[model samples]
Target chain A: MSAASLPAGEPRAIPTAFAIAEALRIAMASDPDVILMGEDVAGGGLRPEGTEEIGGIMSVTRGLVGQFPDRVLDTPISEMGILGAAVGAAVTGLRPVIELMFIDFLGTCLDPLLNQASKFRYMFGGKARVPLTVRTVTGAGLQAAAQHSQSLYWMTAGIPGLKTVIPSNAADAKGLLLAAIRCDDPVVFCEPKGILFVASDVPEGDYEVPIGRAKVVRRGSDVSLVGMGATVGMALAAAADLERDGVSAEVLDLRSLAPLDEDAILETLGRTGRLVVVDEATPRCSIASDVAALCVDRGFDLLNAPVRRVTAAMCPVPFTRVLEEAYMPSPARIVEAARALL
Target chain B: MTRPPTTEVLQVAYRTMRTIRSFEEALVALVTQGRLGGFLHTYVGQEAIAAAVCAHLGEHDHVASTHRGHGHCIAKGVDVRGMMAELFGRRTGTCGGRGGSMHIADLGKGMLGANGIVGAGIPLATGAALTAKLKRTGGVAVAFFGDGASNQGAFHESLNMAANWSLPAVYVCENNGWGEFTPTAFVVPVKDIAERARAYAMHALIADGMDFFDVYAQAGEAIARARGGAGPSLLECKTYRFLGHYVGDPLVYRAKHEADDWIRHRDPLRLFEARVTREGLLTESNLRAIDVDVAALVADAVARAQDAPFPDAGELLHGVFATSDAEGAR
Candidate 1:
């Protein structure tokens, strides 16, 4: 609630991808336990003619392989192997950050993540501490199509033992990611492919925004707009566009999906009395649905209307630009959903 | 790369195999008599691998296990009573019975877990080895997986990473010839799972899994090489399961003769005892004395297990997150 009344600025420039890479580098430098591993992370292990880059799949980890040669590993194209190794390393003493490259590739390595790391401490009766972070690119906009573009945070967030965090902006991305790496739990940090190049002001130094907390980006007293990852940007845009129509919309950035900031959602709903959840994932059993259910269960009396959800339709994300556009939640859709609630 | 283990090590090897065989036999009886709850994955046929491999390991060395893991846990120095109590689902059990047969673990002994997930322990073992290398603990980690788990992604990734980094790890694929109900031939391609090690640039060795001496000799060299920073090795112990996949599994998928034949002739403990007695290195009286002591140990463990209570209901929420509740939920 105190997030409001803070200073506002012109939102300086810091690429979300760079912020992530820089934050990881800082964490790795500070803690020797932190290590990076992924495919093509070292950019084919070749530095041809002034190209001293790791050539990360998304370039989010472009400079790390050069910084920490032994620590920054370029693994084979095996998601299960990469994730499993990260789990192993985390349990043994080192905190490993493995790149899934793309979230869709999770089909190959979900067991180590879902069954093993998530249940280790619980199954072992809390004797284990799996301090591992799996970073993967998610969402559309790259024309990489369905295989590369998916908002699958709902699956990881639903699992009890894992903590899922997705940051919407550069600052939050750096802060939340640092926190995730430091936290003594397995976390799936999904970076939206759509927002990689998008920029915001990041505090150039190491800082960790605690996991399991929410940040209210835009404040208004009418309807609350809840969104995460790339959709958070769209929701904020929709909120800005809605202000001209005299519709007061409070934009809530649902950063940490699992450890849902129930207090923030309840407090905002208690004041706004209306809700609109926007997600890039399919409608059936998504983060949107989870948030809506949470509101109904806890903030039922505070609602002025049935919670509105603007999410990707229940179908495979199409490859075509027009179809993909229709498949994902748009800024206009967020505005319309919130306007309807108002 | 080096000479085989001496006669003294061989005798220790025989003792380990005999202990594992008797412990599993005792557990099988307990399960049939309703003394144990849940399912049991007996390491009945794979005694040589655990005995031979664990003999070379010390307190600093680590080992990760599979679901069929009671033998490794015991061989690695986990209290027999704690393991038995865990199998009985008692509060005083190793994991408070929260983790049954598939999840027995003793962190103090550096036994990560007997993972239910196939091939999952491979990467965890590599990771432990990485920690050892970085911390300069002068130790290595071993992952004992079944032939069925050899084809898994964790196996490949861990092997590649360990070889590339030259981490001190030994991935011993206990080729007991079956994974659950399916035979290894039905799942794996090659007759020797160790041959796959070449793909990752790791050294591979094949050993007689039914003979404790062979297992101990080969595994000892592999472990020494790894601890000396020569990198990971794949030791495929060719063995056969003396019992069904789990307790009470009817050997309907395979011929019952295979299990019968292995128990009668290829049994690791029997083979170990015969070799020791024939060599005149250890007497039958010494083995008989060990048998009596092991029987008492197992019986005492069972008695303590029956007396141990179930975990408190309120403690269910504890241990999921490492931090204090006020810090953050895991």
Candidate 2:
């Protein structure tokens, strides 16, 4: 959904970060079973009442503790413990929405995600239901350096039993977050750090953007730009640039990665014979590659030219502004890739 | 002062210990005969720790276990037949053959899987305790890990979180002095693993893993503290592993007499029987009768496991994820 530049004062309009907090509040209010935990989720631990909550490094969970004092928790700076405990809590009857601060930190606590939470239902003869939602920040562009800015959604999506979703806008952010909390399986809800400040209209109260469904945010015919999370915005910007050049570029926001909307990918390729996949992550084994491969394998007949991919450099996210800009996929890069496909 | 266990509790404890012992011993035959295929970390000597600690846990209380997990599964009320089928990798196994020996679980009985990763289960139980405390379920969570797991970062992180939150959890370290092939002493810096709890400011206790009465008593207080909302506890049971690590593992890691001494003098099952029979809480005939019943039960489980078929090729795709999504937040 292409959210217009609505006035911030407008009703129902909220930033992606505020939308996340709103979704958490709605979830906790409706289901007492739903709780949130992470490092600094409820900041100022062990303090008297009225202390300001940091709501994690990005402040997506800010003001949550004051709202849901008992449910919103501040965990130790331990990713493994946070995730493992969340897994245990989820299977045992609590819907936990945990913040991982940054997706780059997943490597420190992947065992709980890879071995325990993801595999529990399947491994336990379908007896265990891990209703867990891991909300973490992703993508580069903030100059957060390689350590904090890597797009690791590819790793979680590649896993057998994980549901990975990345919303392109604040509305989907609220909807997807709610759906994740309700899902019986473990969901990695990736929030692209680049778009956290972007304002969009979000529906008040509860609504779920179904998992595993992609949204065609901007539709056209000549070419399709495939992207998820932050890359979708770049694709939209690229589509705008392509439109000026009279190249009708369709933007397919691939919100869900694991149970990938293969139908949408093939359908987009059918309408627009040329395709360009834009990704913030590196190209090797990335979602961009996956989509490109999917098109060749399943939509080979639909292709007019070879599928083109615009992705970050294979090297780490550079610390310098100019180098990092070159490292990440930009609208210009996406437009250039789409031109090649056309 | 804590009172001794009742005759009924002792009988229940004996039955659980006997079931675990018989189950592992029966697997020894199956593994030796080449009926079971996967790595089998037998809970041969660590029976008392699982049996006694799990005796205090009910259906609502959760227990996360280590690779040597059958005993924890049994003590926590997982079906022996399903567990046997799991070892056999049959469709009827606890995991529907998706998980082999290292990952059998029954959430209905609060038996979280036998984790393949050494320190993985610590946070799970700690999280379960978080659920118990927040939901006011009056339930406690137990993590039964090896001495080796005490050194894992997950262990330290989980304990620190559990103590900070005052979660209703009991950390049961089955200190069999071996983490995989290496001795626990060679790896862990601390002598009593319970000393690790001090860093978290948690209550700590230790017990001779071979003595069921000692384990049961110490575990009782820990579980009580957890259930009473007083907070978490670390109960380190000084135990031994009869089997090397897995079935068919050569006994070359340590001297043969080390296994022999623990088996002869500190055997949990033998100790239970001797103590009960000597105290007249139970007679030899009564113990023998229980053993016969256990043997029959084990024999039936093995027969059923072997008779069960392997999962269908199509079954490979099942249970990977929730087939569909739920509406709204729950």
Candidate 3:
């Protein structure tokens, strides 16, 4: 893969959605194999004279249809059908970035994800590589209720063959998305809809935050706040609050969940024995529960207190504004959990 | 689109049908003798459909198959020894013993694996067709599913998607009378599965699956239409399976006379040999030679498979991910 086709360097402030779009543009610019397929990936209906284009519901893939007309295919609303086809397309020569619309829709098309895409490499004895990237919206805050709003990265992470990644900021969004697209394995990229417009400085061209690594967004010594996607922002906010009380809290962004950055988790846990896991997903067998187990199993002596987990209430995501807010794990909740652990 | 197949194509087609017959008979013997284990859905009566359809495809053309897929694999040129080894759970199998009988695949030959899940291969084949369309490879993909699969959502979804995208794909429903114990008529409301194509606005064809010449002629038009970028088409073959759903099944649902009639009257291999011999297209002696050669080939495959080893313990965790182990799972 040559890097010259990329839009040249320099960091700029852009929303997470635009950052992901930039990553896609760079991938398509550099490699002709990268193609986009999904429902309304381009808002303009498949009519000849429809002048308007919504790009996507969130416009994460805005302007890509015109840039690469042949590559940005607007598929019919058949989730299982299109996803299965995308898996086929990936095993063949092309790299397909398919939009599942929402992570909740995974239930409708679990066969392609769990049985086909994830098992092809293994079942075919490593002869075929399913280089498919599923970019779906996750997390709740936008009143997009029970069906559209749960963060289910843990489901994909549990599957042995799938790599799950979620970025907390604009820069990581661009880099990690590019990494997911270019990687040769089937990657389920959880793009938290709650932080779609969260803006920060992102590098302009081709870059990759490798899929399995973690980023220590903020360093502290008293208690380590581990988070993923939107929860990372909450962890940072909690770190600021904890610092006011003279208790330095380290914030770790678990960008990739499947290749669960075990070494990084242990390193951060070793440095700060007290750990608080902030997640928007339910606590039952979640990433939070896994990390807490990882700490106890591997870094038992390093602990100064029992591990803490601040997660969403174990119920359906509510549509009401106040109920949803209460359902979500806020920065105040993270601080409370971190303080309890300290 | 319906040009008659050449004599050479007929010879190859006959050999393919003979090979499938020999392979399935060998598996039946093995299963009966307690040598083979698990679900073994043999392609006993439906050889002509796979042979006729696959003859029109090139090496790069892809084929996605269902549980009853050994014939499709052989017609698509999968290595017989590898397929045999897979069923034997040997190391040198097509999937290194990982997929077993239900999941033999050779992508290099464009044979997508025999899927365990019903109706899954429809979209995979459609995806392969989409790849051919995008990459400009001049290739087409074929999905061979059962009468049962047409009821699943994948069948409808893939048909609509392939037609909408104008992809190069041929969906062949080997309507072998039964959908695993129950009559296809009991589950599928339509008399012919090809009628389902009208919903997607796709072209449809029906062929006598037991007659190789008829299936070949019909499949030729469908495949040619797809290759010429005329869009997707469905070809339903009215066929029957002479065996039970799986090797160990009691087959209590269907009367013995029903299977006896199909086996006696409509065996695809017998029909193929009789036609070729009757029209002077091929002699009985030539067809007999093929029968002889196929038996030897199948016997050799079985011998080699029996001698091969199962994969080592370490390999269990090796291929769970690309170039990596199922990490952290000891």
Pitting candidate 2 against candidate 3, the one with the higher DockQ is 3
**Tens digits of lDDT, candidate 3, A110-136:** 999988998888888778888899999
Residue A148 shift from truth in candidate 1, angstroms: 0.5
Per-residue lDDT over B1-330 for candidate 2, one digit per residue giving the tens place of the 0 to 100 score: 246888888888888999998999898998788877888899998888888887787899999998889899999998999889888889888888878888988888888889999999999999899999999999999999988899899999999999988999999999988888998888878889999999999999999999999998999999998888899999999989898899999978899888899888999888888888888999898888889999999999999988999998766667777654331111
Candidate 2 segments exceeding 4 Å error: A1-11, A46-51, B325-330
DockQ ranking, high to low: 3, 1, 2
TM-score of predicted structure 1: 0.94
- Residue pairs clashing in model 1 are A43-A54
Candidate 2 pairs with clashing backbones: none
Model 3: per-residue Cα lDDT at residue A278 = 90
Candidate 3 local Cα displacement, residue B259, angstroms = 0.5
Off by over 4 Å in 1: A1-12, B1-15, B324-330
Task: Please compute and give the TM-score of the first chain of candidate 3 against the native first chain.
Answer: 0.96
Task: Give the CA lDDT, 0 to 100, for residue A103 in model 2.
Answer: 93
The digit string of per-residue lDDT tens for model 1 on B71-155 reads 8998898888988888888888888877888998887788999988888888889878888887678989999999988887778
Q: Write the per-residue lDDT of candidate 3 for residues B1-330, one digit (tens) a residue.
A: 577778899889989988988898899899889999878888878999999999899899999998998999999999999999999998999999988878888989998889999999999999999999999999999999999999999899999999988999999999988888889988878889999999999999999999998999999999999999899999999999888788767889999999898888888888887878888898988888888888899999999999999999877777777735755251
Q: Candidate 2, B190: how far from true, in Å?
A: 1.5
The number of the candidate with the highest DockQ is: 3
